[model samples]
Target: MILNGIITGLIMGGILSLPVLGVAVIYGITGIPNFAIGVIGVFGGFLTWYFLSFNMGIAILVGVVFCFAIGYIIQRILLTPISERGGDSTLFFIVTVSLGFVFEGLMRAIFPRPSISLALPRIGTINIAGVTVEGFKIFALLFALGTLVIIRLLEEHTEIGKSWQATSQNLKLAKLIGIKTNRVFSIASGIGCALACVGAIFWGSLYNLNLMTGWDLGFLGFIIAVVGGIGNIWGGIISALIMGMVMSFSGYLLGGMWQSVILYFIVILVLIVAPKGILGSERSL
Candidate 1:
């Protein structure tokens, strides 16, 4: 039973890490706590379901495009103006939170039903070590790890990624050095949204889709970001895995309701011990 719980938690942690990484990326670059991250993900899942009849690949592609567009639009139309007016981080945070609520309402209107299920094409199950795991769960983990590797490679080898790193390090200096900070922000937002879309698809495959799914993911992602150290993508991933283990153990030993209680308690203890998170830097927002 313990081993089973651990395996399940690890799989779930992989899926949950997707959105948390997205949040970390956006926060690292733009210093905005994008509360609407999950909403964008939920929207993508809905798009996948809407277009599932055509082709799964096409559905996923459309969802990614839609999420990218939404993120870009939000950054360009709303966030840009606010930033130009000298909005602080607090203001940016409030704006994002408000946007999250607005998007949630829009989602509720579009998906008025209580719940909907959109299962991925099953690849059956596989036995690993003595435990049986769903094939889709393996796919989701590999997909997430692959995506992270790609992002890391881009950050190391690409001019665009270098610019992002520079901007993240010092926005004023980046602007002075002729790096188009606004464009970088927009691109970061798009990339984050794309990641969120991927997470949404994987999550939708595992469970029923509902309006609240986005909120749940976004909130949890936020916690994971804080726990992993906001603006540290790798830290977020590691923290997510740790959280998964804790959640799994707590759920197994105690009860389902106690899972969150224990998780939050651990987070508080971590914060008290290391306010900057396990791998977080002093500059982490």
Candidate 2:
């Protein structure tokens, strides 16, 4: 039972951590708390569902590409302009909150208010060290791990990755060196949104999904990012595991609904203790 609990935590945490990873990347670069990410998750999930209703593979491709485009546009049109004024965090927060409501309403208009589950084929079970692991959970973990690897490689290897790293360290300095800060921001935001999309598709396949589903997930992501330290993607993954474990254990004791309240409380406590987060190197705060 103890081994099962640990394995369950590993599986669940891996699957649920993408949004948090996205938040980490975005916050690390833009230094803005993009509250709209939650909406992006739901939007991506629904879009996937809509497309999959026609064809499966195409749905995944379309969902990823569409979310990336949307994220890019938001960064370019809304976030970039506001952020130039230097106090854009406040404005961005307000805008994202408003956008979340708009997304919720739009989703309600487009799809029924009733929950919809993506009917994916069950893969049954896998024998892992004599422990029976749910195939769906294993698949989700593998998907997330693949995304993480791709992201890590992108950040470390390619020219775009170099530019991103340079820009992240010092935006003004990067611009002075001709790194195209605006484009980098757009790319980072796109990647973040894409990550959310991947996360949503996996999550939606496993459970019932709706417009407001991303609400608590978004908060959970933000908390994981904050606790792990923004701007550090690796830290976000670690923090995600811790946060997931906490929530999972709490749910075992209290109830699922209270898990959210517990997360918020943890976030508040973390903020009071280490305002810059656990592994943050930036002096943004």
Candidate 3:
């Protein structure tokens, strides 16, 4: 049972890391808190489910591409202009909340069903010290870790990554040096939402996706990101794993009802003690 809990926690944390990365990446690069990413991701999940009858790979691609487009379009048309107009974090918060609502409505109207479970192929199970775990779950965890490594490499070696770092460090300086800051913001936001969509796909395959799951995911991801140190990618991953353990243990000991309550209470305490976060936002994205 103990081993099971540990594995479960890691899997959960791995799935959650995607959205946490989404929040970290977006906030890191654009300084915008996009509360809508989760909902848009769910919207993409529904799209994948809708197109599942055609082909699995294509459906998944459609979902991810659709989300990327949505994120890109929204950032380009809506958020960037507001940022240019000096919109603060508080304003972005409110705007993104509204955007979430809009996407949620779209999901409801278009999908018809309020809940769905994706039927992804299962890759059997693995036994470790007499504790059996699904192979896909392990894959999810490894995928999460691998993605972080890829992102780190991208930001370190690629031209786009260099531009993202420069723009994030100093927008005016980046713009003066011939970087298209707005385009960078849009692409960053697109990638963030795309990551969230992938998380949603994993979640839907593992359990279920519902109309309200997006809010839960978005809020929880944000909480983990904040506790890990908002805008800090590595910190976000650490925070996600710890919180995943907390949630797993609490759910086992207390019950599902109290799982999130405990997390929120701890988050409050963490914030009170360290106003910034555990790692204090050192190294955004």
Candidate 4:
């Protein structure tokens, strides 16, 4: 039983890390702590649900597009001004929080605040080395891995990624070098939002969707990002894996409800010790 629980923990940890990875990448590029990312994700999942009620494949496609649109619009309309005005980072944070609340309110107005699991055919669990795992969960983990690989490739191989790297290193320098830094930031924001939506839909299919689900888990992603060290992929993945294990064990030893509270303490500890994150470095973009 103990071994089984640990295996389960590893699986769940990997699954939860998907969104954190996306959140970390977005923050790395834009320096915007998007509190509304989770909201966007959950909403994407809801969009998937609404559409999948008819066709599964179309639902997934729509969820991806929907998330991308939301992220793109928000970046263009809201954050662009603040970035241009050299506004306070605190102001951006406030705006993001407000945006999250607004999304929650809108969701409440349109749908109930209860868990609404999408109706999809459940794949049978796979027994691996005495441990049983759900096929969908495996698919989710693969999807997350694929997304990470593709993003990494884009960052490494493409001209757009070069611009992103330039912007990430130094916004001013990037602009000076003709990278259209603002547009880069905008595009990165859109990409992050879209990625968050993908994570949302994947998780929503595994569980259910609610307005608050995104925001609630958004904080979790934030914690993982912090632990992983901001803007560091390796750190984020490491921290996310550790977080999953910690939460899983906490749930086993304590209670599921207390897992998050404990996780926060762990994050606080990591921050106090290495303020720049465990694997974070001050590298010029």
Candidate 5:
């Protein structure tokens, strides 16, 4: 039973890390707290589900690319302009939440379904010691970890990634040095939303997706990021793992009602102790 709980916690944490990474990356770079990313991601997840009958690969690609395009366009036309005009974090938060509602309405109107589930293929199962687990769940975990590694490598080796670091560190100085700050922000936003979409895909596959799931995920992701230290990738991952354990054990020992109660209680405690987050932000916003 203990081992089962541990395994469950790890898998849940790994999957949840996807949206946590998304929030971290976006806030880390653009310094914009986009509360809408989860909704946008769910919108893309529904798109993937809609096209699943045709081809899995194509459907996934369509969903991800569509989200990237949406993020790019929104940042380019709306968010960036607002930022340039001296909009603060609070303002961006309000705007992003409004954007989330628009996407949510569009999703309901177009998809015409209040709930959905992705019919992903079963990839067999694996046994760890005496425990058996699904292969797809492992894949989701590894994928999320691999994405972190790739992002780290990108920041270290690539010129574009260097620009991202520079822009993230000091936006005004990056502009002074001839970096396209607006473009950087847009790309970061796009990637963040894309990551969230991928997380949504995995989550919808593992469980059921409903109209409110996006808000749940979006808000959950943000809170996790905050607890882990907003804008800190490593911190976000750590916080997610801790939260996952809390969730698993809470459900195991307590019940569904206590799951969120304990989770939020821990978050509040963490905030009280470390206002910035567990590891603190890489670059304070």
Candidate 6:
């Protein structure tokens, strides 16, 4: 039972890490709290489901592309104008939050009915040390990791990645150095939303999905980011795993209701003791 719990926790953590990392990356790069990330993810999942009649891979690809476009357009149309006007972070943050609701409403309108469980195509289950594991869970974990690796590689080897790093480190300095800050912001935001889509794919495969699916997950992702150190991708990933383990164990031992209570407790404890998070710096918040 313990081993099963651990493995399940890891799987859940891996599933969750994508969105947490996305939130971290966007926050790190733009200093804007993208409250709409999860809703975007929800939209992606719904898009995939809508197109499931076609090839699954193609459906996923389309979903990803759609999310990327959404992110890019939002940044280009709304955020860019606001930022250029010297809007405060608080205002931008509220706008992002409002964007989440807007996406949620859009999703609700598009997917009027609750969907049946949309499981991804999978082989079969595997038994490891007397514990039965879903084959798709392993695939989902690998896919998530692969997505992260791809992002890391892009950041390391691509010009866009360099621009992202520069903008993240110092946006004004990046602009001064002739970096196209607006373009970099749009690309980064697009990538972040794409990451959220990846997360939504795995999540939708694992559970019953609905328009509201992203709400709680978004909140959880935010918590994971804060606990792991906001704006730290690696930190968010590690912290998500830890939180996944804790949530799994708590759900098993206490109950579903207690899981949120315990998680919130951990968040409070972490904030009081180490507000910067496990891997975050003094300026992380």
Ranking by lDDT: 3, 5, 1, 6, 2, 4
Give per-residue CA lDDT, model 1, range 1-285, as digits (tens): 878888878878888888987898888888777888898888888888888889989988999999988888898888877877889878877888788888778777876465777767999999988899989888888887787788888888999888988888998999999999998889888888888888888888897778888888888887888888888878888888889888888988998899999999999999899788888843322
User: What TM-score do all the candidates reach, one by one?
Assistant: 0.95, 0.92, 0.98, 0.93, 0.98, 0.94
Q: Candidate 4, residues 133-205: lDDT per residue as tens digits?
A: 8887777777766767887888889998888888888888888878877677677777777777777776677
lDDT for each residue of candidate 5 in 19-71, tens digit (9 for 90 to 100): 88988988999888999999999999999999999999999999999989998
True lDDT of residue 115, candidate 4: 70
Taking the tens digit of each residue's C-alpha lDDT, what string does model 2 give over 118-169?
A: 7777899999888998898888887777777887898689888778878878
Show the colliding residue pairs in model 5.
none
* Two-way lDDT contest, 1 vs 6, winner: 1
Per-residue lDDT over 138-244 for candidate 3, one digit per residue giving the tens place of the 0 to 100 score: 99899889989999999999999999999999999999999999999999899999999999999999999999989988988898999989999988999999888
Poorly placed runs, candidate 5 (over 4 Å): none
Candidate 6, 13-103: lDDT as tens digits: 9989888877887787777778888889878888888888888899889989999999888988888788789888799879988999999
lDDT of residue 130 for candidate 4: 82
lDDT of each: 0.84, 0.77, 0.92, 0.76, 0.91, 0.83
Which portions of model 6 show Cα errors greater than 4 Å? 281-285
Best by lDDT: 3
Give residue 248's error in model 3 in angstroms: 0.6
Superposition-based RMSD of candidate 1 using all C-alpha atoms, in angstroms: 1.7
Measured with C-alpha atoms, the lDDT of residue 281 in candidate 5 is 76
- The segments of candidate 1 whose C-alpha lies over 4 angstroms from its true place after superposition are 282-285
**Model 2 lDDT at residue 155:** 67
